[model samples]
Target: MHDLLFTVPGDEFPFTASVVVHVDGPRHVVRRTAGGDVHEVECTADDVDRVVDEALEALLAPIQVCRACGTPSASPDFTAVFERMHYICFHFEFEHGDADRDQACGLAGCPAG
Candidate 1:
């Protein structure tokens, strides 16, 4: 297993997570300081790529963009999850929020709602 540390922006600040990737396929270990260890299901290569992309976004320290107007959120973490729509993109406020969502681009500043 190759352990890699990825830094991401938290609600208040930046944080780092340690990801131990198996040389083989599927299983991996992910741990964050605030949230402790996170258990992930068997993930595909696409999932890994997505996570890496998110980390890169955090590196830029981007203000979360509104799912509606493409506006960079002035107060991203404070934006309410108004009318949970779908995965337009970015700022994963909730992990399971995308479980039953559509790709509609209209929910005000609900960045991850």
Candidate 2:
């Protein structure tokens, strides 16, 4: 389990983005969520390059339900996986659930905290 911590700013909200990549027998499992999903890619256990490629693919897969919003993103995959996931996790933290809405969402149009 890799715990990736990021946030828009102190003013917006706080959230954690996590991705776990682990070998389970013959495949590599990629897991993350803001109550979203997990993905698995097939690869040999010893092939580091394959493992990385599979992991990145899993992370970059287009979402039917965007973690930032229920609808599909306008332009997804324009950024690095971590950058995109960080925004998703941050947005979800503030926009969903019992969130404090007074602050800017910080996904866009806000000072960097």
Query: Per-candidate RMSD vs. true structure?
Result: 10.8, 14.0
Tell me how many residue pairs clash in candidate 1. 0
Candidate 1 vs. true structure, TM-score: 0.30
Cα lDDT of model 2 by residue, 8-87, tens digit: 22223333323455665566554443335444444455774665644544443544234454344445553454234445
lDDT of 1 by residue, 2-111 (tens): 66665433544344343334434555433333246564434566576665544444343345555545555555443345222233334334433454444423456544
Spell out the clash pairs found in candidate 1: none
lDDT of 2 at 5: 28
- Provide the lDDT at 99 for model 1: 45
TM-score, structure 2 vs. true? 0.26
Top model by TM-score, which number? 1
- Displacement of residue 8 (Cα, Å) in model 2 is 12
